[model samples]
Target: MTKKLFWEDPYLSTFTSSVISVEENENWPGKFLVVLDETGFYPEGGGQPWDEGNIGDGYVSYVFIKDGVIYHVVDQDPGKGAIQKCRIDWDRRFDFMQQHLGQHILSSVFEKHHNAETVGFHLGTETVTIDLTMDSISDEELQKVELEANNQIYKNLKVQSLFPSVEGLKELPLRKQPTTDEDIRIIEIKDYDYSPCGGTHPAYTGEVGMVKVRKWEKVRGNIRIEFACGLRALKDFIWKNQQINSISALLSLKDVEAYEGTERIYRELRDLNKKYNQQSRLLLEYQVKEYHREAEEYQGISLVSLVFEDKDMKQLQTLAAALNQYPNTVALLAAKGDKAQVVFTRSKDLSLDISKLFKEVIGLIDGKGGGNPITAQGGGDNVANLQGLMDAAVIKLKHEYVK
Candidate 1:
């Protein structure tokens, strides 16, 4: 069994130890697994990531444990030597320590105040999240938990890691029971909290700096709280402050007034859009009247077949519906811009199956569409042939059905 030097001195950055064993990692090519007599590198376990740094000449990329043995995945094979130097990346290690401890304090607060249990935890690169037993929590209630968690951090209570005997475990009020009975490791947060954990943590709660719940959402009948601690929380604050300042300057409002100012601007834009749509509808009605007047009459059927430039398919459908309101009228419309489009419709008084005629014409433009006998619409990339497609529809109607 390898000695866990990390448990002895979590802050130990550099140490010398013998390279006890070396083996090629079967799963990772060009990588070697090196085991030392003692190590400060924390293996990936307990919802905490593995510590990465240097082992002799090799860069340690990942660390893991298999059947009670810790393995360090190295980029290069640290040669056969009696003693090799190992160094822990302190920044990465301490950041994880802060987040891990912050989770303990926050979880304890949730349990104490709301009678909620922490069902899951994930320490991500950008944020840490804890899944709680409760399905929902009010903002005011969450604010209380956040304030209490930060209060514990400010108190700077002593954090202790204990290896208590199985019999001795009955005396402490642990937040949760350990999964294993043998060799149980417990983390006690002074008088605040106690729980079984193998993850590394700082000596004092103050090292966590602060605990801020960024947001929360319900997931699988539980509430998942996304949070940040210490440096991560500080970085989050800086980014949000910059955004607020930029918005305030742009709107000529104070930081506190930015929300209201943005809301007002959104309302004005929505109202303007409503007015523009009204005016556009009025213009389309007038254009429809002009097109109806110019329609050609063949055998008592008014054929409103026309091609427009840069017109949207929605507008074409609206025009077809309007023209179909007239007696014994058929609207065959096409538009050309980035693509060719066709819309065909007939009045309720007529029994012309325009869908069949629509199919024959839209195929000229390599388009696909379907509709009932009264209306059909489609578009294709053959914009240059859109007018020809419209004319084909008129001929198909006059020859096949209008007769």
Candidate 2:
């Protein structure tokens, strides 16, 4: 088994260790796996990613543990060397440290106050998430949790990781029991949280900077809270502040009143849309009467054919249905726009297959559609030929069905 030096000193970035074994990774070509007698590189485990850096001259792309041995997957072979220097990317390592510790504090507060246990955790590239046992958490409750978590960071309490003896474990008030009995490592947040975790963490809670809960949603039977810590929290604030400022400027209101101003504008727009829809229905009724009056009679069938500019398909269907109310009437309507649309329908009294006639000419505009013998509608990208599409449908109806 390799000695996990990272557990000894989480802040350690560089170290010299003897190369225990070297082998070409079978899963990945052009990559070598080198095992060290001792390593400071943290392997990808416990919802945290692996540390990336260099071992000798080769770039260490990934680190992982297999059967008690930690292997550093490198871009190039470090050659057979007795001792090689290895380094972990400090920025990435420190970021994980902050996030991991922030989670400890945040989870402890939830379990402490709300009786919610952190069932799952994920340290993602941009954010960290914890799945709580509770299905729902109100905004007021979350606000209190966030404030308390930040308070823990402000306290700068000492965070200690130790392998406690069996007797020592029984005395401590742990948030949760350790999974293993032999080698139990507990992360104690000084007089506060005590949980079993093997991941790296800062020496003090203040090193976490801050913890911010971005949002939360119910997943499975639990609530998953998406939060950011340290520099991640700062970046999130910066972007959100910019967006709020932009919205306030657009609303012509103070930044604090932007939400109310947006709500007012949204309500006004919704009212206007409702009024517009009412006016549209009234106009369709008037047009239906005019279209039926102007229909051309063919073999006792009233063919109502017309075209409109930039019209909605729903409106076209409404107009077609209204015109078809008249006896022996067939409506062939098309709308010209970026995309062309056509709707064909016949009265219930008429035995013509309107869908068959519409399909034969829909391809002229590169469109597809189908419906019952009474009604059919479709649209296509060939906008310039929309009127021609309608003309063809009208002619096909007169030639094939009107007879």
Candidate 3:
């Protein structure tokens, strides 16, 4: 069995060890696993990701434990039977340590205060999430849980990892039962929290630095609470303050009053949008009347063809519907924005399949969209040739219907 140096001292980031074996990893091609007689690289386990660092000159891409051995998968081979310098990424290792410890305190606090047992945990790169068996948690209750956990951190309690014999374990009051009967490693956070964990951790509660509960959501009858800890907590704090400062400056308000100022701005924008929409509708109504006056009749078919600047597809549909109100009328409208949109519609009295005709027209510009016969709409990159597209569609109509 390999010597578990990490369990011995996770703080030991750098060490020199003899490579016991070297084998090409079958799962990940081109990479090789250099097994050291002892290593401090914590392998991926217990909802915690693996540690990565340098194994000699090569990169320690991944680490995993199987059958009581630490396999350091390296990018470049560091031959067998050679003493190689191994260093764990201390920043990453310490970050995970902080998050892992934070999880324990948070979990213990929830159990003690609310009797909400943690069913799952994930120490993610961005956030650490703990899933509780409870179906729901109120805002007030969640705040209390967060307060309790941070208080634990503030207390700076001594955290101990003890290996107790099967007989000795019966006397300890563990917050949770150990899953494994043998080699039981118990992590006790002073008198506050006690649980079984094989993962690495800091020696004291203060080392966890701080913890913050960001948000929570319901998942399959469980509450998944997302949070950040240690460096992550500090990072989140910095980012939020920066954003608040920017908003406050733009709104000409104090930092604390930024929220109120933002809300006021939102209301003003809403009112402006409402007024803009009313004016646009009135304009479209006037435009439809002009179309009715200029409508051209061919073989008793009243055709209204027009194009507009920057009008959306919704406006095109509205204009088409207005023209269809008249008998035997066909509305062919196009709007130009980044692209050219063409809409074709006919009254129920007409026998035109605009969907098929629109499909053939859009092929000229390599564009895409479709609709049924009564109303068909599509757009293409032919912004400059909006008039040309209209002329082509009108010619196709004249060839089929107007002799």
Query: Which 10 consecutive residues of model 3 have the lowest summed lDDT?
Result: 394-403
Best by TM-score: 3
Candidate 2: how large is its RMSD?
2.4
lDDT tens digits by residue: candidate 3, 1-403: 6788889898989999999999985797999988999889999998999999998999997899988888988998898999999888999999999999999999998898888899899987788999998888889998988888999999999988989888888888888898877778999899887789989999999999888999999999989999999999999999999999999999899999999999999999999999999998898789888898799888888888888886898888888988898888888888889888888998988888888778878877667889998888888896787787888889898787544
Ranking by lDDT: 2, 1, 3
Q: lDDT scores for all predictions?
A: 0.90, 0.91, 0.89
Question: 1 or 3: which has the higher TM-score?
Answer: 3
lDDT of 3 at 129: 97
Clashes of 3: 0
Q: In order, what is each prediction's RMSD in angstroms?
A: 3.1, 2.4, 2.1
Instruction: Name model 2 segments beyond 4 Å from true.
Output: 80-82, 312-315, 366-368, 379-387
In candidate 1, which residue ranges exceed 4 Å CA deviation?
Answer: 16-30, 56-59, 79-84, 277-294, 317-328, 346-356, 363-376
Model 1 lDDT tens row, 328-356: 89889888888887889999999989888
Q: Write the per-residue lDDT of candidate 2 for residues 1-403, one digit (tens) a residue.
A: 9999999999999999998888996787899989999999999998999999999888998899988899999987777666888888999999999999999999999999999999999997787999999979889999999999999999999999979899999998999988777768999999999999999999999999999999999999999999999999999999999999999999899999999999999999999999998998898788898899889988898888888886789878888879889998998988887788888998999888988888889999999888989999999998888778877887777777777
